[model samples]
Target chain A: MNIVIIDYGAGNTKSVQFACHRLGFSPVLSNDKDVIRLADKVIFPGVGQASNAMQMLKKSGLDSVIPTLTQPVLGICLGMQLLCNTTEEGHTQGLGVFDVAVKRFSNTLKVPQMGWNTIFSLESNLFLGLKNDAYMYLVHSYYAEICEHTISQTNYGLNYSSALKRDNFYGVQFHPEKSSTEGAQILNNFLTL
Target chain B: MLTKRIIPCLDIKDGRTVKGVNFINLIDAGDPVVLAKEYAEKGADELVFLDISATLEGRKTTLEMVLKVAEQVNIPFTVGGGISSIKDVDSLLKSGADKVSINSSAIKRPELINELSAKFGSQCVVVAIDAKQIDGQWMVHLAGGSIPTELNLFNWAKEVEMRGAGEILFTSMDHDGTKDGFANEALSRLSTELHIPIIASGGAGTIQHFVDTFQIGKSDAALAASVFHFGEIKIHELKENLRKNNINVRL
Candidate 1:
């Protein structure tokens, strides 16, 4: 399978590639639209500022290419946030793949809500075979509010959309690559889809 | 709310897991990959690999071990010990480590933290501070707690946070390997003072110690080595105890 990892100059693609290799798949890290479009699966993984990431994507013209993907595409962390209509991280606009906006966690609790948290309300095949409320790792200051496309929800000060799905596009706010066994299982599930 | 974390630290030397008493009298623990996999399966929230090797050759072996462990384990892994520059951090992270921790080097050049956090978000930079109490003040130590610096623990912690470190891994040289308890007083102070997460390290002997560190120390995570390596404390039972204690730990 040609699993392409969207590499838009973010410094967080190594682990994602390793995750793919561990799951018995060789992933190609590329910014080329043709390669990404032709792949069996594309993973948009990132852990950086949205404004700069969007700028890079725009400069490479990947901003237009990403939304056109018909194959199963998974967006992780900042990549997930970039799939929304807008984000508060850098006052930047997103691809609008899902009808939602990313907002910063309220100051009432610790920001960046990092560490292992449980995911409930599992509704998609992405969580196939996994127990409900399985622990997955997360680290971010902004979160996507629950929306019509949300397939799973997690609570950290407030319940937010931990996972979202719109047709062939899927997104997870957590870092499944860094998350343990169940996380690896989720990646396998995505691959099977 | 995010659940409290239970991190098992593995001190590696010559590519083998090792444990020491108060930073002395080292003994072989086990294979890091095996132990790490067991810890993750038993519900360890994360794993920290600290290379305590003294020679340059040994550090290279540690990197290879990191590659092996990363290929097998699926948990978030942090690699520490002798990380001096961005190149070192790059190699380790590229080798599949989720985070790179720096200690004495970060102290010598505080800007290293800024540079690292700039290149690879603060989430990837973990500044580890090995501290010891001297003259009624908790002072930062260097070279694995052998050399004392003028920097105070609390002051250095705040400085690291300001410098863009994502988290601070505070190890009490006085409390490490003592098996009595953690430095909750200092851990609590560090927690209340810093905005970022504080990982309380050293002196975790019992399940009650874990409870106290989370409750009294107000630590975001608690890390221990010997008790876990020696099998004196099981990860599942410890987490069960924490859950029973009303602490929100992932089971």
Candidate 2:
């Protein structure tokens, strides 16, 4: 099965691609809609503000094709925010893959948590092999709040949704591509699905 | 809760790492790739590579070295030295560098901080400030400690932070390679003043120095050299010591 990583002029695309290459899954890196549509699993990764990211995605016509994907689609970092109904980073609409809305974190804690942090899996399947409190890499200021689809949660300043699953669509605020062994295992689980 | 970090810095000149006692008698440590891979595998939270000899050559070769080290390590890495523009950062990030550190360029044109942050986000740009305590007042130094900028450390650091620097890598030129300890006074002031994470560099001589720096400096991360290069202390062992000191760190 071809695993396609959608590049919307975001960050850490090559590392994600390289990690997939090491996992025996040579992912196809492209912004082309046709290539993404043909893949068995699609991994959308972005590491920038939601508003400007949506602008770039719309310019590339990804905003139209993203919600229509029938395969198991995963979003990482800002990719997860773009999958939400709305984001506070910019004045733009998301693909509405999930019912939640993304908002900026409170000024209490640091804006961007840049190291490894623990995430407790709230649901099954997506975190089958993963431990209950495995640490993963995170680097973001905006978070997706819990809705009807939150499958995982992590507390920072207060409790916030770290992982969400709705139908075949999944979203994670952490970077599985940059996280250590636990992150690789998460990617492996995403692959078997 | 987010755990603080400990980083080991490797100063490379002409594609080889060098060790100095009082910033002299530079000895060939080892291959950059080999050492970087060792540090990452040994549980180093992050790594910083400074091209110490940027004046001798251009940036093409240094970025090539960055690509080589990045291919072998899976951790976050920051590259600095002679990076003058946005295209330079793009090339390094394209080569898999997680962060692009700027020193002389940031001092030359403060707008570079805004430009890079606006384009790639502040989290990707690290402003490295090398300051020397002169007449009891910390003064900022530029051009790899070769020249002094008239800007004061406190004012300059706050200005850079306001301009959208994701993090600040502050080095005390007076303490660098001295192995006495960190500039606690400067670090404390910066830590309490800015909301962004600060990585303390220089004067890391012993394992307790790291613990003291973290506990007293109140920095989010502490970066060291010499000790790690001469095998004075292993990265994991230092982290264990930091943990024993009641500091919140990833073990």
DockQ of each: 0.64, 0.57
Using Cα atoms with residue i matched to residue i, what is each candidate's TM-score against the true structure?
0.94, 0.94
For candidate 1, the lDDT comes to 0.89
Q: Which run of 10 residues does model 2 chain A get worst, by summed lDDT? A: A107-116
Candidate 2 lDDT, A1-193, residue by residue in tens: 8899998897578878877876888888889999999999999988766778888999999999999999999898888888999988876688899888888778766677677677885594778778877777777777888788999988778778899988889998887776666777888889888
- What docking class should model 2 receive? medium
- What is the C-alpha local distance difference test score of each model? 0.89, 0.83
Clashes of 1: 0
Residue lDDT tens for model 1, B120-190: 78888889999999989999999989999999999999999999898989999999979999999999999
lDDT of model 2 at position A33: 90
Cα error, candidate 1, residue B30 (Å): 4.4
Chain A superposition TM-score per model: 0.98, 0.96
